[model samples]
Target: MEAFTTHTGRAVPLRRSNVDTDQIIPAHWLKKVTRDGFEDGLFEAWRKDEEFILNRPERQGATVLVAGPDFGTGSSREHAVWALQNYGFKTVISSRFADIFRGNSLKNGLLTVVLPQRTVDALWELTEADPTVEITVDLVARKVTAPGVEADFELDENARWRLLEGLDDISITLRHEEDIAAYEAKRPSFKPRTLTV
Candidate 1:
């Protein structure tokens, strides 16, 4: 997983609520275990519609997604996060998110921002009014800011630190590899003698 620190980029405003995992990448796309190339499946169903937010060229390569409430609900597939990353979304801002989805997203280095409904609506409106509008997510400060809005938020200290350093769970554990090796070296290795019966 790539580390996340501060990201600033064009915003893609998705006003729909209750976007589930299946809608994110669909079940068929799950056949592949590798995380690469799932961008084709990101919002597969919605992308079919000519008017979907993602279909607009202005939103292409957008790194920040301003979405509605209850985002990433329904299923617990980590693929949802994978699809978002593959589709070039680095940060997701919404009024709320499913706990499991949020955890999965963080584990994959996708920053999920939880803000008040009013603030979310404001951002949605602002971005909609201007397709080129940009937003910034500052992990260190735990804040999301735009032209007229600045909202402070919270995240687990450990998660925040991990993202700032671009370290995933495995990378974090590997940081203590030397200590683990030393401990294993100190432990006595013994084989039990077989008892003749």
Candidate 2:
């Protein structure tokens, strides 16, 4: 996970609501064992329509997603987060997010910003009108900023710290590597070891 302090980029506005995980990345795409190739599968169904927001030439290369309410509100698949990240989205802005989806996104270093419905609407409008508009998500300041818009958001301090430090679950565990090693050294030879020498 890369440390996230602040990110400023153009956004892709997904106007539809209730965008579930399957729509983000269909179940068929989950067969892959690695994360990199999922980008091709991100919104695979939606990409079929040239009229889809994501298919618009102006929205190409957007790094942020300003989506409607109830975004990521279905199955608890981490692959959804992987698809977003793989598709070059660094942050996702919505009025609401499913608990599991939000958790998965944060763990994978994808910033999920929850804002009021009106605020999210404004962002969608702004991005839609001008695809070049740059929206900045500042984790350090806990706010989202764009031209004529600034909204404060709330995230627990621990989650904020983890993002700032680029510490995923594995990274957090590795921080106590020395302590773990010491404990393992003291274990009886007959005791079963979870990690091989």
Candidate 3:
């Protein structure tokens, strides 16, 4: 996963609530073996509608998503995060998010920010009013900054560290290379061997 320190870009305001994994990337798209190419599936159903916010030309390259409350409120699926990232969203801001979806997003280096409903609404208004408006999300400062908006967000230190260092689960386990090598050397010859670093 790519490291996330800070990001500044335009945002696409999505006012609909209860956007689930399937809506983010329909289940049909999950049949693919690789993570790439899901960009086309991001909001596949909604994209079919000519009036969808994402379909607007001005918001084409937006890297931030300002969504309604209860964003990502359905089943656990990492693909949702992938689709968003593939579709060019580096950060997501909302009043609330499903625990599983938030976890999936963070682990994949997609920052999920939670703020008060009032603050989120303000952001939505700002972006919707001006598609060229830029919003900055600073992970190190745990703050989001934009014109007339400055809000702090919280993220556990460990997750923050992982994102800063670009460490995934496998990368984390590999950090103990020497320790794993030492333990494996002392294991009983009769025991089955596990993969080593």
- Give lDDT tens digits, candidate 1, residues 1-197: 68888999999988888878788889999889897889999999889998898999988878998888889987888888998998899999988998899999998889999999899988988999998888999998889989999999988898888788877687678989999999988877573448744
* 3: Cα error in model 1, Å: 1.3
Full-model lDDT for every candidate: 0.88, 0.92, 0.92
Which 10-residue window in model 2 sums to the lowest lDDT?
Answer: 166-175
Tens digits of per-residue lDDT for model 3 on 1-197?
A: 89999999999999988988889989899998997789999999999998899999998899999998889988887889999999899999999999999999988999999999899989998988888999999999999999999999998999999998888788788999999999988999777658753
Task: Write down the TM-score of every candidate.
Answer: 0.85, 0.87, 0.87
Answer with 1 or 2, whichever has the higher lDDT: 2
Q: For candidate 3, which ten residues in a row score worst on lDDT?
A: 188-197
Clashing pairs in 2: none
